[model samples]
Target: MKKIIILFVAVLLLASCENQEKVNKKADISTITAESITQVINELNASNSGIDKFLMEKGVKHVANLWRDSDGSEEEFKAFCKKNYIADVTERELVFQKISRNIEIITGNFNKITLELLEPVHLNTFEQHAIDNEFGAYSVDSHWMNDFYQNKIAFIIALNFPPFSLEEKEANAKEWTRKQWAYARLGDYFTARVPAELLQEAGKAAANSDVYIMDYNIHVGHLTDAAGNRFFPEDKVLLSHWNLRDEIKANYANTNDGLEKQKMIYQVMQRIISQEIPEKVINNGKLEWDPYTNMVYENGKTIEATPEPNERYQQILNNFHANKAIDAYYPDQNTFIKRQYDGAKEISAEATEKIFTDFLRSDETKKVGALIKQRLGRDLEPFDIWYDGFKARSGMDESKLDAQTRKLYPNAVALEADLPNLLVKLGYDKERAQWLGDHIAVDPARGSGHAWGGAAKGQKAHLRTRISEKGMDYKGYNIAVHEFGHNVEQTISLYDVDNFVMNGVPNTAFTEALAFIFQKRDMLLLGITDDSPQKEALKKLDLFWSAYEIMGVSVLDIRMWKWLYENPEADATQLRDATMQIAKEVWNEFYAPVYGVKDQTILAVYSHMLNSPLYLSNYAFGNVIEFQLEQQLKGKSFPTEVDRIFKQGRLTPNQWMVEATGNDLSATPLLNAAKEALEELK
Candidate 1:
C-alpha cells in the first residue's frame, strides 16, 4: 500500500470557456444595459498578452510551485524557485496573482448561452453577479441538470491543443463541436446526481426524492440511467456521485470515434501503467495535468537501471519504499532510456503472474474460480478490474452510496438540493442565502472536475459542473464531499460578493479547502470514531495507507511525463519499460521501507494516468490544505464557520488558506499531521 489516494491530471479550474450548442437564447437581463456588459466582456477577452502578461501567472506562488520545475520533484521546485527568485506567499498577504480569467468574449458568450438554457428550479441570480457578455449574464437561476459533464468536457475543449497528427484549424473546429456535445450530455448527468439524491429516500411514498430527480431529468436527452429504466432511473431516480458516472459512461459514450479514441488512449496508457515498458517516461502530451511518471514491476525480476548495479537496485528499491526523495535524475542512457530503466535484468514472468493470480483468488468474483482470465474481455479490461475491484472492496455497495446520501439529507432535493442552504447554514439568510446557492451551484457547465456554477443571484435557475470520479470509491466520496463543499462555497461567495462576475473565489484550491472541511466527516459521517484503541489504529492506517499509496503513483505520473518529453519517440514497448522502471524506482524508494514490501506499484492502478494528464498534484495539494485546515479547525467552534470559509470563493487559494488557517499550502502540515497520527499507531 502506497500513499496516494486520488488519481488523474492537471486541473485548476475552467477559465469560463464557451460551450456551443449552435443555438442562442435571449436572456431576461435586458434591463441591465447590454452595452455596458459587452464593454466588460470585451475588456476581459481582448487583452493581447492577457492581464498584462500572465495575469494568470502573477503572485501565483502556490500555483507556481505546482508547476515550478520541469523535473516535478521537491528538489527541482526548491532549485527552480531559488534560481527564478519566485516568492512564496506570506501569511498576511492574500495573493492570488495567478487566478485565470478567460479574456476571450467567446468564453463569456459560452457562459451566456448556458445561462439562457436553464429551466425548472432557477438559481437565485439577481443579487449575485455573473460574467456577462453581449448576450447576457450567465445566471445560475434555473435548474440545469447536465452541468457536470458539460464543464468537464468544456474544460478539455478550452485547453485541448490540436493533435500532433491533425491540422490546427480543423482540430479547433472539431474541439468546438466536441465541447458542445459533451456539455449537452453533461446536463443530463447533473439531473442524474440530483435525482439520485431524491431516489435514495423515495421509499414507498409517491412524492419521494426519486420523484424529485426523475421530474428534474438529469441526463436530459437520454432520460435514462446506466443501470437502465428499471434500475435507479425508472425508480424515478439516479444515484448521486457514483451512479452518476455510470449514467454518463452508459448513456453518453461518444459515437463519432471520440469515446473510442479515449478508449484507445487508455489502452495505450496501459503500456505506461501496467506493462511499465518505457523504462523512463514523461508526458509531452501537454495534456491538462502533466506529471513526471515512472514504473517498475517486481516479479522478483531485476532490471539494472544503472551500470555497475547489482544489489544497488535493491538498496534504492528499499529506499523508495521509505518515501525519501532521492535527487538522482536517472540521467540519460544509451543502453537504457534512464539510468533506472537501463538495467540488464528482468523479473521472471512466473513470479509476476503469481502475484496477480493471488489477487484474482479473492472472493470478489461471484462466478468464482472458473474465471481464470483476469483481463476478461474488452468490457472487462485490466483497468476495469482495478476500478471495479476497489469499488467492491469498499464496504458500501457501489449502487447504494447515493441512496444512502439521500437518507442523510432530507427536506431538500439533494445534498446540494439547494445551494443556499450552505449559505443559510453559514449564517446568511433569505436573499443572501438564496442568491449564492442557487446561482453558484447552477452556473453553466464549463468543463473541469467539480467546477461549481452560479448564475446571478436573485434570478431563478440552476447549473452545476461535473464532480469527476469514474474509478473512485470511498475516497471519491470524500472527494465528492469536498466537491460539494466547493459547490457550497460557490453558492455563498457568488451570493455574498459585490461584483457578480468577480463574486466567487479564485483558483481550484479554495473550493478544495471547503471540500477538505467536509471530507474530515468521512469517519464522522460513517459514525466511526477513535473510540477503541483498535479503531484509532485503523484510522491512522487509512490515512497513511492512502497517502503512501498516492505518493508512489504521484511519483510515477511525474516521472512518465518527464520521460515522454525527453524521449519523444519511444515506441510503445519502450514507453512501457520506461514507466515500469520509474514505477519500480518510486516503489523501492517510498514503500519498500515502510510496508517492508520489496516492490509494489499497486498504487499505479490510478485512472488519471489513463485519461486526465498531470493531475496528481491537486490531490497532493488537497491533502496539504486539508491537513492545514484541520489543524485550525481542531478546537475551534467552527460549526457554521466552514460555510463562511467557503463563501469566500475566488479569494485565491493562497489567500483563502491564509485567512482560513493562517498558513500557505505546504506539505509540512500534512506531514506533521500524519506523523502525529502515526505516533498514535505506535
Candidate 2:
C-alpha cells in the first residue's frame, strides 16, 4: 500500500490557471520575521477580547507564516483573524462541522477523479501512451493549495482550526471526545503551503519511478548458467525482487534443484543491486543471458550486453531530490522522514527506531535464527533472511499448491466472488462478510499486487492482485489474500466509521496489521488446516522471525533516508555505495550474530526503497501490532474483534493499540511467545 499523504486533502482544490504574479510574490512568505508574527498576534488579541491569548497567538502565527506580500499587509492579516475567529465553543464546533463536511466532499471527489485519470498508468490492459504517462504524472490537485491560499480558504482554516503537534495529540487524545478528535483532524488539514509546481514535480518523480519498477520483469526461463544450462521453464517470468524473492522461498522444499534455483535468483538480485544486470535481459525473453557471468547470447551466438547504468539508484535519487524540494514549506516537520512519522504516521521516527532496534538486538531474535538453522540443518545465508520453513505451506510442494489455487481462482473475478466465503472462514457473519466483499473490486495488477483504499464512502476499495494467464498461482494467491486484507480494512474503515474525517486507520501500519491478520489465515481459507499440536507455537515463531527480518530492512531504510539528507548533492553512484555500506552495517550489527554472517547487502534489496520511499518500516510496525492483536484475539470472534478495533479510527498508534489490546505497541509479547515456542518445539 502507498503511504497516504493526509495533507494532500487541503491542497486538492488547485485552480486550472493560477495567478503567476501571486505565486511569485508568495515565495517571499517564508521570509516573514518573528517580529511580524508577534505584531499580528498582539494586534489581533488587543482587538478581540473574546478570544483567548492562546488562540490569538496560534491563529496569528499560523496565518502570518503563510502570509505572502501578495496576500495582504499585516493589518489585513489581523483583521481577517479578528473577524473570523469563533470564540464560543458551540459556534466553533458548528464551524468545524461545516468545514469538515465540505472538505470531505471536495477531497472525496478529487480522489475519485485522480484515481480514474491514472487508470491507464496504474492498470496493464493496454500499452500506455506518452500522453497517458504525462497525464498520470500531472496531479490535478497540485495547484489547489495555491488556489486555496489566494482565495483565503487556507487562511480561514488556519485561523479557526489551529494545528496540534503529534505530542499534543498524544497527550490530550485520551481525554478528548469524538467531536474533539474530528476537530483535531481538521486542524491537520492546512499545516503547510507547499508550492504547486514542487508537488507536481514530486508526483512526476514518483510516477516515473513507479513505472520503472512496474515494468522491471525478468525472464526466468531465459536465465543461463556459466555452462549455458537452462534451469527454469521457457514460460516462466518473474518481477524483480518480489516474485524473484518469493520463488527463492518457494524452492526451500524442492530438494532436486531448489538450491541451484535459489542461487541463480540470488545472483540476479546481486546484479540488480550492483547495476551490472544486462539491460536486454530485463522484461525481455527474446535473448538468453547468463546472469552469473553477465553474458548474453542469441541463437547460440555470443552478444554484447550493457549494464543497467545505475537506473535503479537514479530513481531513488529523483525521489530524494523531489522530497527535499518541499522541505522548506514544512517548517515544523521539515524532512520527509519527519513528515512520514510525525505528520502522516503520528508516530515519532525515534520511537519506532528504538522499537525496531531493541527487537532486532534481542536474544529472542537469536533463538529464532538458531531454530531456523536447526530446521534447515545448515548454516544460514544472506538469503535465509527470508526463510520460509516456519510457514505450513513450506512443507507442501509449491506446484501442488499452485495447481489448487489455479483451479480455484482462474481469474480476478473468481477471487472477488469468493471474498465473502473467505471472510466467513475467518469468522465474519455471512451478511457482513458479503457486504464487505461487495465494496471490494479485484483487478489484475501489472506488477506485484497492492491494495488501494477508496477515499470516498461509496467508492469501492480496489484489490489489484497479479494473476497469470494460466491462473492465480499459490504465490499470487498468497499475495492476493494479503491485499484482500487491505481491501477489507479499507472498506470497513471508510464505510463503517462514525466520522468521515476519521475514516481510515491511524496509519498504513494499522491497515497492514489487519492485512497480516487476514494473510496468516490464507491456508484456512483454502481448506488446508494444520492440526499440529504446536500450531500456535509455530505461528508465534513465524511472526517473530518475520518481524526480525523486516525490522532490519526497516532500519536500513531509515538510515538510507538519513544518509540522503546528509549528502544532498550526491549522485546515484554515490548514493548506491552509501546505501550498500549502510545495509552492510545494519546487517553486521543486528543480523550477523544471529545468521553467523557479516557484510551482506541483501537487506537493501527491497523494491520499496526505489518506489515507495520509507514505507518498509510499516511492515515491521505492522508485525508488532499484529502480534499484539493476535494475543488479544486468541479466543475472541475474529470479525467482531477486528471491526470493534479498526472502527476506533485514526487515533495515535499507542492510543489505538491500548484501546484494542489493553497495551501500547511492544515487542515483549512476541519475544515471550517466541521463547515459549522454542521451548515447546525443543
Candidate 3:
C-alpha cells in the first residue's frame, strides 16, 4: 500500500553512489563495441540452437550494457551469457517465476522493515527522539540494488528477461496474457542502477519533507482580527493546507461568520504560499496573529516577526536535485518527469496534459461555474473553487454530522471495527465484507490520513486516519472512508491477483479513483441516504466542479515542474518567484473569468507542490476515472463489478479502462453528464 499512493521510496533508495562509481569505473571498457555485441549474439545463437535470433541479440546487448570492468573482459561477458541463457521458453519462464517469487519476499520484508522504522516519524505516538528521526530517515533497500549487481542477480534478470519499452507495452499489452504481463513486470526490475548513497540521500530528503508537512499546523482559534475578535473555537487546530481548506468548505454551511472565516483562511493560505507568514505563527498557540495585516501579538502587544524565509520552496528544490541526480542512470526515461509518466504512471505526459486541458477549456466548465455563481447569489471568489454545495450532505449542519460521526467512531479502533459493515453497505456479502475488512488495519494518523497498502500477501494494509481524543470528526470520517477504499483496493489487487508482479492498479490515479468513489458515499455509510429527485444531477455537477478546480491546480503543478527543469540552478527564492508567476498565469487563463479575478496565487497553496512533488495531477486524473467508473457501476452490482474490474491488475491505463468500463478514459462522459445536469437543474 505504501507504493500504491505514496511515492516509491524503495525504488528511489536503490539509487546510490556505489552504482554510479561502478558505472564510472567501467567507462574505459571500450572492448564491448556494437560489432562485438553483434558477434557475441551470433556466437550465442549458433551455440544454442533453441535460442532464436531476436532473443540472442536482445539478451547479449542487455548483458553487454550492464557489463563492468569487474564483470570481466568482452569474452567473459559472452561466455557468461552463453552459459546462463535459458534457450527453451519453458525453462526461461521457470527462471522468471523463481526470480519473481524471491523478489516479492525480499521487497515485501523490506517494506515491512521500512514501515516499522518510520512509525515514530509517520505516526503521532510519542515525542520523537533524535535516534527515531535517524531511523526513520534510513532507507533499508539502499544497498539492495548494488548488492544485486555485485552478486550478478541484476545481470541475470536483465540478460534473461529483457525490458520492453513503454511503446512496446502499449502496443502489445492488450494481446498479452496475464503470464506475459507478469514477465514484462519482471523485466522492469533492473532497468536502472543508482547507488546506495544517493538512494539514502533521496530518502532523507523525502523524510524531511514529510516531517515538515506533518508538523505544519495552525492554531486556528488563536487567529485574531483587527478588533482582536476570535472567530474559531479555542481548541481548533488545523493542519495546512488540507485541514485548513476543509475548514473553509465546512464554513460554507455557516451563515453568521462563514465568509469571514473563509476569507481569513484564504489569507493564511496566501501567506504560506508566498512565504510571507510569520515564523512564530505556524503551529504555535502562544501568539495571536492577524493574517490579513501580517501582525503578530502576545497579550495585546505587537511583536516583530520575520517571514518564513522560503523554507517551503527549499524542500522542493532539494527534492528536485535528488531526483535529478538519478536521471543519468535512466537513459531512456531520464528525467523525473519521464519516470513519473512513462515509467511509473505508464501514460504519456502529452496524453495527461491533453486530458486536463480539453476538460478545463470546455464549455462545461463555464456552465458549471455559472451555476455555482447562481447558487451563491453572487460572483465567485477564489475560495469558491472548493464550494461543497453540490454534495448531498452540504445542506446538513456540519456540527450535527460531526456529532453523529464522533459518536459512531470514538477512535481508530471503532472505525476499524466498522469496516466490515461499511463494506456490506457498499453491496458486499457479510462474509466477504468481513474477509476484506480483516485484511485492513486502521490507525490514528499524525497528519491528515493516508492509506498505506501492504506490500505482500498476508500483510494487512494500513489505513491511517486522523482522530482526536474526542473522536473522529465529520471531516476525519469522510477522509477515513476515502482511505478505506484505497485499503480495499490494495488488499484485493495484491492478495487476489493472478501474479505477484501485477499486484496493483495501473497507477496511483486508479487507486485515487476508487477512493473518490467511496468518499462520495460517506453519507451512505453513516445511514444518511439522499432520496432527492435531483440526486443524480447534483452528483454530476459536483464532480464537474471538483474536476474544474483541480484541473487548474494540476496544470499549475505540471507547469511548475517544467519550470524547475528549465531553471535547474534556481535558488529557493528564485524558485518561489517562478512558482508564484506560474500560479498567477494559470489562474488568469483558466480561473479568472470564472471567479471574476486575475493574478490570484491561491492555486500555488497546495502543500503537495512542495512536499509530494508533481502529485496534484493524480487527483484530477482520479476524478475523471471515478466519473467513468461511476457510470459503469450504474445498474450493476457494486461489489461484484469493483472486484471484477480491479482484479484486472496493473494494465495500461487505457486498457484497464476499456476492460472495466467498455470505454477508454475520456472526459466526454463527465462533460456530457454535466451538460445534462445543467439542463435538469434549470
Among all candidates shown, the one with the greatest TM-score: 3
The estimated TM-scores of all candidates read: 0.41, 0.94, 0.95
**What C-alpha lDDT does candidate 2 achieve relative to the native structure?**
0.85
TM-score of 1: 0.41
Q: Rank the candidates by TM-score, best first.
A: 3, 2, 1
lDDT of 1 by residue, 537-609 (tens): 3333333333434444655666666666576555555655576677777656544433334444444535444
RMSD of each: 22.4, 5.0, 4.6
Reference-based lDDT, residue 196, model 3:
72
lDDT of 2 by residue, 142-253 (tens): 8876888899988888887778788888899789888778777777878888887888878989988888988899999999998888889999999988999999999999
For candidate 1, the lDDT comes to 0.35
C-alpha lDDT (0 to 100) for residue 399 of candidate 2: 89
- After superposing all C-alphas onto the true structure, candidate 1 shows an RMSD in angstroms of 22.4
Give Cα distance to truth, residue 273, candidate 3, Å: 0.4
